[model samples]
Target: MRFVAMCSAPAPLDQAAIRVRHTLMLLALLWDADRARVDLAHELRLSRSATGNIVNELLAAGLVQEVGQREDGSVGRRATLLRLKACAAALLAVDLGASHARMDLLDLRCRTLGTRTVAHDITRGPGATYSLLAGLLEQLLLETRIDRSQIALLGIGVPGPVDHDTGCVVQPPNMPGWDSENIAAELGRLVALPVLVDNDANLGALAESRFGAHAGLSDLIYIKVATGIGAGILLGGQLHRGVRGGAGEIGHISINEQGPVGRSGNPGSLESYAAAQVVPALAAQLRATGLQTRLPDPASLQDLLTHAAHDPLARAVWETTGHHVGVAVSTVLNLFNPQAVVIGGRLALAGEVFLDAVRASAVGRTMHINAARAHIALGTLGAEVGVLGAGAMMVDHLLTPRGLPLLYSIARRAGQPVAEATPLAQDAASRAPPAVSAVYTPHPSPPRSHPYSPRRNT
Candidate 1:
């Protein structure tokens, strides 16, 4: 999966308030039975005074409460425990993919209440996808019984390139008729809630970094090699999204100049060769058409992958695709030199043959430091990752609130506009040590560039 970011005009905020709120939410995610206020202060690297102010604000908002004290097992007063009020608010997460769309309801503790999924060919068109998504959303809303007023925020993850400003599919290959549309805004009118949109691959990466497999790894790559190909990059704990929404468009990297044109047309793009988009049909041809392959007619992605593990023709196809994957991933490894590359998606089911081939080729082509330092491994999150990532996105948007109320879930509650917000510097300083991001080092997010099919290759 790829992690692409869009450039947007900064939202006005009460910087101090946002910081406190954001820090509290992060603490909530990191909180557990061993929770302690001092630990919170230490983990966030905030001064006692600053952490106190934040905790107080959350307490006043009725979002948090002091549960009890932690026994230090030493000759010291017990430290008080703080945690989220389970019923504080609700969130909605949407995952729109090539084959299916789902909506989930989550509480403050990151518990899922209700989920609804629909099986529709989203790639046929965007309008249809929207309608189907709307229906599932309605069902989720009804099933969860969450009032529009109780809904805190909405987070959406979609396949293909995302338009940062509009929050829709910019140039998805499988899904058609989604270009330059503000899907978040359109769905807002139907549900009336605040919404945040991001590419699925990017969300997958963030999910891993925040709560999934790649957690605690500051710099890592999460690659999705299913119906499509993309990568998600996490640097210093924050997701690395490019200026435009196509930063990790690894699938479009042409492997051979003279090969078949890809979905996004860069000739021999990774998806064109690696994705399951063509595998089922190809499997059918080989099995039904009596093309002389050892493997019988394999229908699903699993079937192909299983066959490839032993079938000669399937093995050849997998090896060929692995070469392309290594060619593309080696560049990323060389450039970023992340400590790990976690590969996922339907195609990843092809297993050891694909992984071994890609790894061998990548090791041969890339710097020894890059190859040796970063372990190329399969993700353990599996198929549910997209939905889980979508949930994380929702939690993120809720935690990092801006002053202005967004247009995502229009029928949802109104957050005070960001224009009248204040910064965290207004709070008194604390003596506590800070965490890694306390200084907030900046990475340049590029301009809003679209990933369109260029008239010709460079």
Candidate 2:
């Protein structure tokens, strides 16, 4: 996900301190951990009194609720467990690809309520794309019977390099006319929600880490080999967007300095060799060399895959492409040494032929230590991975101090204000040192026991 700075207000230091504690508490509860009050206090390095104050505010705001008492067979009194109120609010997640878009309405816990996909050309520029997304969102809301006011945030994953903080897209080679466009401002006008924009590949990485077959892999790399190729990287369970958000443009990695030029003016870039769009042409070129094949001259990627089961030429082209991908992945393995590398997007559909080739090439090239630990696998989240990732990012932001205002605004519009101050919180105005530092440095969360299994709407 992208990083957004916490919004500072001209409020009293005590209030700011309380807000920080509240944000940290929410994060501790949201990470699929079954925690009690004392557990939260311990994890956040806060006093029990301060933890109770934050919990009270969250409970009043209807963002969190006590489920039941924990029963760990401890000798002491059973501590009551807390969980984020799943139905407190919902988020709108959008995945914008080079030629299609998918949207999902997700609850606070990232359960999909409604989903929709539509084919559209992203090259039409920001305005047209925004209009189309707005329409799709309207359709999704109507189908789900969700009110506009219930949507707490909008998270969109675009197929481009995004300035995560500004919500602006950089000069993405795949997305023409999207350079320096502030997608959040443009899309916010139509959706009327706080918008978060991030790279689609990064979202893929986030989704895979949280919900794919390789769920719980903190240090992972998700490579999206679609119309364009790029990578999403995670380090210590956190997204590494790098400085200026240009960290994962693997498609521009040059394999042949004198090979064909890509849109980015990079010669023999990985995209030129391994992207889904290039597969058909690669097959055609191989066929021109008098190779026997039943497929037509101008076969689509789908057609090639369908014929690949028995077509030697089709298999050859995929293997070659996979080799190119493996070359780049080898470089990734050496540098990042991630725990796993997940391959997603259209080209991943080639199945074993593609994956096996990638594995062979990558494993053969990288250091044995790095290669041995890294698991090369396919993404199980399918077409909705990007949307899921967008939703996950939104949920994460909503639990933070900066994003709490957006949720609070939604709550106010719904006529739910913060709960009245209690006797325990009467001394909130007291000037005292915070129990913990303002900076939150959370320990890496463990993998969820039950990862999300995506359900498609009938």
Candidates in order have lDDT scores of: 0.62, 0.74
lDDT of 1 at 282: 54
How do the residues 310-367 of candidate 2 rate in per-residue lDDT, one tens digit apiece? 7888888888999999999999999999999999998888888889999999999999
* Candidate 2 backbone clash number: 0
Candidate 1 matches the true fold with a TM-score of 0.77
How many clashes in candidate 1? 31
Q: How displaced is residue 304 in candidate 1, in Å?
A: 1.3
Best by TM-score: 2
Superposed model 1: Cα runs more than 4 Å off: 1-34, 38-54, 75-77, 280-294, 298-300, 306-313, 401-458
* TM per prediction: 0.77, 0.83
Candidate 1: 10-residue stretch with minimal lDDT: 431-440
